[model samples]
Target: MTASAVKQGQTTTGHALPILSLAVGTFGIGTGEFAMMGLLPDVARSMDASIPQCGNIVSAYAMGVVVGAPIISLASARMSRKQALILLTLWFAVTNILGTLAHSVGALEFWRFLAGLPHGTLFGGSALTAASLVAEGRRGKAVGHVFAGLTFANVVGAPLASLMGEYLSWRVAYLLVGAIALIAAFMIWRFIPRDDPRPGHSLLGELRAFGRKQIWYVLGVVMLGTGGMFCVYTYVSAALLHVTHVPLWSIPLFQGLWGVGMVVGAYVGASAIDRNPLGATIGAFIWNVVTLSLFAFALPHLWSVTIIIFLLGGTIALGPAMQMRLMAVAGDAQTMAASMNHAAFNLANALGAWVGAFVLASGFGYAATGWAGGGIAIMGLLLFLLSVRGEPRLERSTDSSVRFH
Candidate 1:
């Protein structure tokens, strides 16, 4: 397979161009996913629907992610990574544009759900492809490079798309998102050489990931531990208004600062994971505990609150290491395992928001969300400890079989 040549770093195209094409694909996905949130009010107004009603469209997309990941992974199990990436991007581009043109909320929701169907699968292909291009222990850095596009979208792509929606039309904004996806598809086709699937690829091999307990533990850690991000983030606007008392106009700036922190965290996390995946995961959780706990106390002061939010965002550093660990244990089922990572991310978002809302409804103040999120992080950490208890300090990925420790 030509992929093996690329994997060995012997291809004339090298790794940068192919990896970059994948990153652009992720950038488009992230921009469309997040920029839609900012465009919701306009969409609601155009459709004569309530903002609450429009929220279902967002939920519909997330639901698609959860439903689509596993199915797509199974279906595409034997396709070359490059082909999978291109097809997924094209699907995203078309469905997103179709959803943007829908005149009714239900129609839009249906199309948006279709648009989301490719999301997790695309990320899975991109991560695996990127990691495959590097040496064994360096996968973290390669995966991080792909994810950097998603983080950067938070900083630039979403903001620009949101601005277009605010100043022009929401339809125009989403069409631009489709354009980015289309461009990503074109770049992938032009850059990624024709290649074949790995030897002995089979759906049964992919299914084997589920039989391993470690995969479940990694997913649980992500769903619970990483969830603290959304727990605080979901309510951050409210917190800024009620506790931090920031002016409404400055809220986006604070959010942008958080995105900046994520960009930095990705790089640092990549290096940490390359050195020690286990240690990086533990350190990230510990960092989350401290920042989340401090968030409650810091709310009264603007600078302190600002710093806390950034640090909380920086906890994204946990993602790459955790994902690498999953890949390590997944054995031959790495495709399914990697695909589930983004699905768990969406689940975490829902879980965290629910927990944050629960605390608020139970008479806990906005500040209490920090503590609630902190408590969840602690639970995740404890679960991880139990998961790895009595196991070796390092997991060996020398072969394509389940690695217990």
Candidate 2:
């Protein structure tokens, strides 16, 4: 139901229900993924592991995203996008349900990795499908709307899961995440309209996309820019504990503020991208540097840290703009590049959490993670500028987007 698809009398776009369903799945994924950041302390204590040791689970999950993106994208190239989305959520559901059965840290890492396997493909397919539904210029907003479910999860789902982990059994929290993912699968199966298989996109062509340096630069921008956010966010609870000296019970409540920032960032960033993709991308990197630097300074003051966490979540603004940028330059390998986009993101997730853990293990305070994150963001902004100096910043027209039979 793209603009071109509509003009061709193939399909007209107004399928809010399908997009809603996609958002639901995104929400479930976000809840399960982000919730762990706050609940890692609980997990660490339960497994009799150190907090830094427990952070390996985050890296494990992100590694799954990195490994799974390209493999699944290639495997599903001929399948219906709708079918792929449903199966990915089902995969997430099963993994999380099984994750509750894990007894040791190794087991926890394994199940979390399985859960991560579906992460990149689901987001990639969801973004592409959402783009297919909208027109040329508005694709950024549409993708943002679909991704809003993730940001909103930070507000509601992740915080709620943190509470569940704190008060109830953390197992119960994992069980709840599984249940939500199951519901998302059902919603995807029910709401998303059927479309025939896309045949012309060759798998070899997908590989060819990798040869382009722009794609690599885009991936690097996402990885570095996003890594900074995860560096602080992955250890938010610890910061609250050691620095802010806030009540332990207040962790989840404060975590909700981060989500509010994400929700705001998504809309604001999407609007900016709709007008100027490169400019939005530039501003997003700068935003991360400022917020992360502020977070380092603000950690001791509870109120200031709270404000900065929200602003830090605003780094999510880079997501949509970067996503659209990939599709624009990918040409025939749009699907592959789109899927790899999340691969890069979770790679960032892995790198960021690992770096955060590293900084902490080296005796740096929790606040030092912010300084590290700011430095990373500066590197990302510089790399991005170097990548796009001679390239066009505009997204490709809807006419270039995939058209289904």
Candidate 3:
């Protein structure tokens, strides 16, 4: 379970340490990223803006990811994965530090945008790095383990960080995140293997990744499928506040439980994907459709809502499944395609938030997020089915390697 053991890929030693390190880094990032939502009232009050206006910060950050992932991934393709990760984490620390010191809403938004520039690229590169270090059949689990760091952040880091912000000051949370990023940078530099940069890995080669059709299909699946989850989750706090009648003090506890559900879902999903990736994805999507609908109905009862939230977390299994599926389909352009997966998911994040907000603004009530989410899940399912059915059959002499854009 130690970092050293994880570095050695010793399955028996628990892989816990490296996962913990990854999780710690993710914890800081998640805390800094998500705590803003909970602290919106405080941020708006301090900056003298409306709640919706402060939401512009979130949009700005997402735009950063939409712009940053491909640029960073291609620009850094020539570097070793480990070195790239370290460099990315270093930038993470700097941007977050600036975020903590911003004097105005405009300044804060700018810094938050900068802070997000490394977000998707970091996860994409880290997932690839984690996969490269593991044996076959365990690759999915390893990637899941690394991502568990982020998921755990939901359960533990975000709630605690938000509570600290609520009790103390939001600025303190950003400080903690900056410090953790620094630690992750140091750990990545020290423990990660040193390898020569790839030969002729140019930005042009990376851009060529778009030449394939399957890539677009994968992206479609990711954006639509995962968007459903975000539609509900992006508004969970609001739901609890308005419908469940949970006290502000109890909000973090519920959110933390959702995180725990994510952790369990992630590990179990990893195992399932390793066994049968395609089947697992389909099943997970279907499961999301059903559970998310049930979640909407249970929202009025606190105890039932909590359990439903945990069940809803199971939808995260889609993440690893889609990620692995993209790897299979991406061929030589694995790097950019992998990085783009996170980009696609974040796009889902933006879509889900916008749509859910629109529904709420239209007077449908807070519980509309679940219906919004379920609608998204069903759309994703249809797309997946079409993708599979539309796949062209090959002649005996022709080759078939799943190609991804």
Candidate 4:
């Protein structure tokens, strides 16, 4: 099977099995990535580390993502997407299990970093595969379907893992993630169709995609704007406990509500991107400014903060829009661009957590993360404007080489 054949198979047969299989992989990845936030307190106790120190564990995982995406994407350039995805899933499952076996903070961080190595490559390969399976105009919705798994992980997987961590152990949470990943690997092997090797695919070609200015600008938007959300999200448990006075048992419920918001945002953003990708991207950043700005004021009231967190979760809408924009500008190097999207996001994760931690360590309140996040969102909007100013005429051309759909 070839890439075109995969697209035709989906269109003619109306079969979504391949995309559904990919979603299973993303669900596992999402759970492994975000469940650590909820497990921070438990891990801190286990490692005899401070909350800020635990934050470095999160940063460690993100650093792995930033480093692994391009290298994995380029290394696997000659392989079929199916082979790459399966190998990546296997790597993911093994590393997550290793994470469960860690005995100290340094060991745990190392395991977490190893676990993150396949995160971006899997998502990128899955996104490109998903996009290839649909009509050009429906690419955003297809990618959104894959991401829905991630959002659903937040809803079901993250909350359950958090609850298990609360009642059982943080190690148990990692074990659960590993189990899900194992299932995903099986699903992909069983359901995803094989494709022929991509012709002329090379590491050098993938690297050259970065020569485009718009790619850098789009990545900047991801690193800066998306970091704002991570700034708030990374320490959400701490804030809920210390600031909102929420009970320990209720943490999962609050996280679940945030997931619900993401689920809604995914579909809405996909539709918006299909219509106007740039508009959707800008709008999400603007919305982030509003929601994150209110986070500080809302912190004093439980009901108000709950609402704000939900809205903040909805900022995930920016993801698909930015992804579609990257696809539009990547020319033939779709896989590289797609992988770098998550790399940029985890970079945002690292940047946001570092900044948020800085403020908290300096005698600023937890709510200060909200102010920091809002400021970053403003910078993201400015970058978006700059990207728009430099938008090449070819980007707007109807040429098949540049057109996304």
Model 2 lDDT tens row, 238-301? 7888899999888877778889999999999988988877678889999999999888899999
Q: Against the unseen true structure, what C-alpha lDDT does each candidate score?
A: 0.80, 0.84, 0.78, 0.85
| Candidate 1 Cα deviation (angstroms), residue 282 | 0.3
lDDT of 4 by residue, 109-175 (tens): 8988888888888998888777777666677888898999999898988999999988899999889
Give a tens-digit lDDT track for model 3, residues 111-212. Answer: 988988888778877776666555555778887887787788788778887787689877887788898899988877766656567767656767776887
Off by over 4 Å in 1: 1-13, 48-50, 197-200, 395-405
* Runs in model 3 lying further than 4 Å from the true structure: 1-20, 390-405
Clashes of 3: 5
**For candidate 2, what is the TM-score?**
0.95
Which prediction has more favorable TM-score, 1 or 3? 3
Q: 1-405, model 1: which lDDT tens digit per residue?
A: 233454566532367887788889988998887776666777998899986688677777877887888999988888877788899899999998887779999999998889888888898778877776655555678889888888777777766765676678788888988999999999999986667765558789888878899899888988888788778876776688778788856665776777788888888988888777677788889988899889999988999998987887777887787777777778778788988888887777778777887898899899998998898899889988887887767455323342211
Q: Model 4's lDDT to the true fold?
A: 0.85
Q: Rank the candidates by lDDT, best first.
A: 4, 2, 1, 3
TM-score for each of the candidates: 0.90, 0.95, 0.91, 0.95
Worst 10 residues of 2 by lDDT: 396-405
Native-to-model Cα distance after best TM-score fit, residue 140 in candidate 4, in Å: 0.4
Q: Root-mean-square deviation of each candidate, in angstroms?
A: 3.0, 2.1, 4.1, 2.2
